[model samples]
Target: MFAKLPLIDYQPLKIIDIAQVYCTLTHPHFSNQIITDIDQEINIIANKSQITCQQSIPKHEEELKIIAVVKQLLTNLPKYSYPKLSLKFKRIISLPGKSDQAIAYFQTDLLTDSISTDLIGGKLNLTYNLNSCPLYFSLQSALIRQQDHRLLPALAFEGEFAYGNKDPREILQIINNWSEDWLTFKEIINQGFLG
Candidate 1:
């Protein structure tokens, strides 16, 4: 039998307090040294084996613009690391017909892709039915290269916490737990696929 993970105590926080976060990590081979200043909200880091871009306060429309900028930067590079891309966004949401007085938890596998004798990649959709509302979480990852659909390295995760809740302490705790689990899962993927 396996032991269950310990849950953290609830700490209330306003939705606005949680800044919108975006992260992208590519394979080492695709890493380059060209850095372009996009804006104050965006931060770019270029290393020998990877290029990472993080948006502090990301907007829906800005996603496309960011991707375009990344593509343009990639063009300047002479070589490509198998072309792996990962995008993640997190925000708060609201659900109707859900009571804030109930406690529930649900999760399911949304999709999966694998290779022989190994779990290559997949996605998991989760819902936390709380007393105030339901929080939705979507995580998607793959090891396939975007250019030719060949296997590479990639991962993404998005968590949407329900808004309009009277109390946020419980929700914050849930988010904390989910984030811890996500970190562990990411490490596994890093070792298995990106390593």
Candidate 2:
């Protein structure tokens, strides 16, 4: 019977865009042949959200792969072959219905980076850096209506995080555990406090 209560039946918001995974590998151990092999075969994996690289590794070649999480997809990129590399991951969350006043829902303090224009609605972009670690978090607002017959405002917010200078295995583990992190992030954002 309690299921009917408005508060009890509250449903959390959902992300609209597929997560994009990214990675950047830099190490002195990479051999010229290994780099060339990875560069030559990197194009075969076309799906940005679910990337997997399969290449022939030379003798003594390190089996290193960085699996980055974007949205809900897992990207397995071959990194043992590169001496320097970087990738970007992005995900978007949106709310439907009358979002005419959606900009007001966001807090001002969290608007560390913001842009406003007459063509589109207000936007907020936030960035957080772990001073001691090689990791950073970024959030941005992308609220614009698309060209459609029906009124569907693209009241969306994007969240992204990047990390570097870590072991490939450790990076993979973090990517595998990102689901829980995503859940916690969603909950925190839903509360209208990105701080």
Candidate 3:
């Protein structure tokens, strides 16, 4: 799904401070057994909206361990209905010329009856900092109304990478890697957000 989107490759960039990947599932029930089944090494947080497992960057060899945990969670989910899945990747890049930094936010959401109708899609907002003289840009897809009264099978990738003091190409490379990993993760579950 990400392949179809435009690639972000900007020049004169710097470092990435944060990288986050997340997904949402449609399970309304909670199971303690499923929680127990996860490896103790991963951090699992169960909330009203969803169960989230998060981990900081692991050693190169431990990547598979993280993937394994994600797969296990998906396998335990109920198969009766479609799940809401979302993947987010974020980084902070530094700019050499400016004392202040810029921020960019991007996101897309499917408009369903469950959501408010006033929401708009494809939103972009920019703000400037007078002290540091930096800019912040926010980009997002408007809420696309669903024709049918059901929740549209869709996935949204959102968030922004902060512009810091590292190489721009390298920051994009990291984003690309994370995006590819997300694609592989989706394939492992044999599910696509947009069916």
Least lDDT summed over 10 consecutive residues: which range in candidate 2? 1-10
Rank by lDDT, descending? Answer: 2, 1, 3
The numbered model that scores best in lDDT is 2
After superposing candidate 1, which stretches have Cα over 4 Å from the reference? Answer: 1-37, 56-64, 92-195
RMSD per candidate (Å) reads: 18.7, 11.2, 18.3
lDDT of 3 by residue, 73-106 (tens): 4556536222433333322232222121111112
Top model number, TM-score: 2
TM-score of each: 0.32, 0.46, 0.36
Model 1 lDDT per residue over 16-86, tens place: 11222222233455345755456665566776655665554433433434444444555555344323333
Model 2 earns a TM-score of 0.46
Superior candidate under TM-score, 1 versus 2: 2
lDDT of each: 0.37, 0.38, 0.36
